[model samples]
Target: MRHYQPGSVVQMVRDAIVGRCRHIAPRTFLMVAAAVTGLVTGVTAYLLKKMIVFVSKSVIGIIHPDGFSLWFVLLALCGIILSAVFQRYVVRDYVEDGCSRIIMRDLRERKYYLKKRDMIAAFMASSITLGFGGSAGAEGPIAFTGGAIGSNLGRFAGARKSDVRLLIGIGAGAGIAGIFQAPLGGMLFTLEIMAMPMTTWAVMALALGCVTSAMTSASLAGFRIDFPVGSFSDFSLGLLPAVLLLGLFCGLYSVYYNTTGNIAAGLIARVRTWWGRAVVSGLMLGVCVSMVPMLYGEGYSAMGRLMSGDYGVLGVNSVFSDMATPPSLILLAGAVLVLKGIAKASATRGGGVGGDFAPTLFAGCVAGFFFAQVSDALFGVRLPPVEMAFVGMAGVMAGAVRAPLMAAFLVAEMSGTYRIFFPIIIVAAVSYATARIAERVIRNVKSCAERAR
Candidate 1:
């Protein structure tokens, strides 16, 4: 037998694979690539989640929930500063707002290719940010990472730009589906949030990718992401009024969140130095988290507790724990709903890397609970808090993200039932309409003022 160099053997194997690929039909190749992208994206999502969890447990897990500690301020500060430094020095690129960046690139540049570094940059930066207790979500960075994976894979295969775009969507959809274990939600996100034009082939590819990713994620994590739910209360016309009011409440809250989030981000952006921004972000987060400990991290744990009827989780680590009475808890929940947007913006803009997805849902959950309490106290309307919270999650998310169907479907998947599907749709629709109307009013008012000047 002829001895071959190790390098020669690798090259021969690569040549064989490439030679075989050349014979495969383009559509078949694309479909195979989509499946591979989904599988890889699922792994990426799992790793990102594990990194965040490990970091969080190492840092914040030491703190006692029965009492208060300002150490979280330091942890939050360090996390943001580290993420900013990593982005500026290590990555040497802007990797935040992955979704927006992807959309802008596709629309403006017609370039479906992303740098290879992107596959890991957002993952590392966001891991550090969330691990250190930054109030942001992992979904955005994973989506960005996934898109890069798909884009690069297509480009490597010498695919056309249109084909590359489809790959990008597959990667993104797979990422969302993997993280949330909601395949339909993931596909909808690409179509609705990414604004990808849907074709039959595109839909099929997305479905394959999303389902694969979600299955991978579920297998790796050993469980699906879920929220505790109350017994399915009978839906009656009598409950319609409360459902409508909840939708309106969610929409108005979404507007407030968007407006304040912008203002907060703008304020932080004024800081010239990375350290200055970090300090400002740290101080802002420190104050908010100090007041409401649930403001720390993505607040998913708190959301779980809220859904499970454990209201004490809201005030447990808070300095305001002394006032954990029902009335005080209601007030605290309202405060969380108000401050979450600011906290999220501060973390993301202040050199930390994360997405708004979790923060939006967390705020929605709190908003629903707060509304339920206030309604019960004032009007004696005995709405199920758990069910209302579930609906509110979809409503505010729908309004804030401007993707009603995705939001509704995501909630359906999380709840593991379609019993509440119709209510979610009703709330999502009203919330979307209300947000649109409010946003238009705000815009026209601003324009009028500008014209007057």
Candidate 2:
């Protein structure tokens, strides 16, 4: 290895690259930069996912696979404590509420510099939380990490504000693409979820970034769709009524989801010390997880089990295992659905780190499954629980995150087909509308109560 003069060779190389960049069209340069960002974000997503999996497998290895073990609660509590300590001491930064932070910065159109630690802090914290069964998703943390990567890249290149903002969107979109391997879904996420205005060039850049990230992740991880609805003849005009009802149910469920999360966070925030918050959250989460083992982690495996018609897995390693009847299983699903939001809130607010995407999707699956079972048992109407589960995912996510297009496209891509696209679109629309109305009513009621006081 040869040593160069300080600020000599490095500065010369930087100047050379900057000079070359000046000759290129702005759009062309942006596209190139977006692709590079996508590549980097993809690798980061892959690494973060592997970290979670490694920790998750290790934790699961020690647990009794066939029966309930009290160790689940203890191990999960340890994870929350460890994550809180790491964030407070090692990271020494504010890394929570990553998606909200990004949106606020974008809405304000402020020139904020995301620190280098921001790129890795959420990634590490979320992995520890989820790996130890902290009942949350990875999507939000990865998006935050990706946005930081894009922001820092723009800062390094001295890009304009508009360009930096666009890059941030691209990175976030690519991050989702990398994690889910859904290019179209990723583009929709950036456009709808991020509330970014899209021009022809911007759309092109976002698409390129998302596609490249998806390709990279696929190449590295060997592409596989987690929940695949192989063949279903259950979607018809007769089922349309059920679909509509499910949509309404999901809408109301989304209201509960948002409300529960907010309430839990608010309650946890009252704790004066970080350890106190962790202990409080840990007790709540442990009780939920102990009673319903399916509530642990992102609950993807539980969702898959439901989709495949193995409802018994919902009660695995939990107190509900003995109640294996269909009606009882439906009730168990309902319990998991409600408890999931609380568990997710506990994980993130209790010094752990995670996202809402997984929890909402998990709840949607449960809601759909529960509705199908109850409808058949009560009214003697048979609806496909599997298809309903899939559509419910889109509906709940659309309402919870208020991104119908993103939710619809994400489900479509996840299933690798457009067979259920029409139902997904309808359900997502209904759910979003219902959620909006419910939120307004709740807001008015609170206002009235305050005025009376």
Which ranges in model 2 have alpha carbons more than 4 Å from their true place? Answer: 1-13, 100-103, 106-109
**CA lDDT scores, all candidates in order:** 0.84, 0.84
Mind giving the per-residue lDDT tens digits that candidate 2 earns over 1-453?
445587687666766677777788888889988998899998888888889999999988887456676777787798889888888999896565545455447547664567788888898899888999988888888888888888888767667778888888888888888887788978988887777887999999999999998889877887877676577664578778888888898999999998998898889899998899998887778778887889888887778888988878878887678788878988888888878878888888878888777788888888888888899889998888888888999999988989888888887887778887889999999999999999999999999999999
Task: Output candidate 1 Cα RMSD.
Answer: 2.3
Looking at model 2, residue 318 earns an lDDT score of 73
TM-score of each: 0.95, 0.95
lDDT per residue for candidate 1 within 1-453, as digits (tens), equals: 445687697656655666777899877887888999999999998898899999888876676445677887888888888888898898787775445455447646777788888888899999998888888888888888889899888777667788888998899889888888889989998988888886887789899999999999889988756664745766777889999999999999999998989999999989998789988997887777777788889877788888988888878767777776768878888889888989888888888889877888888888888888889878887888888887899999999989899999988886677887888999999999999999999999999999999
Query: What's the distance in Å from true for residue 418, model 2?
Result: 1.0
The count of residue-pair clashes in candidate 1 stands at 0
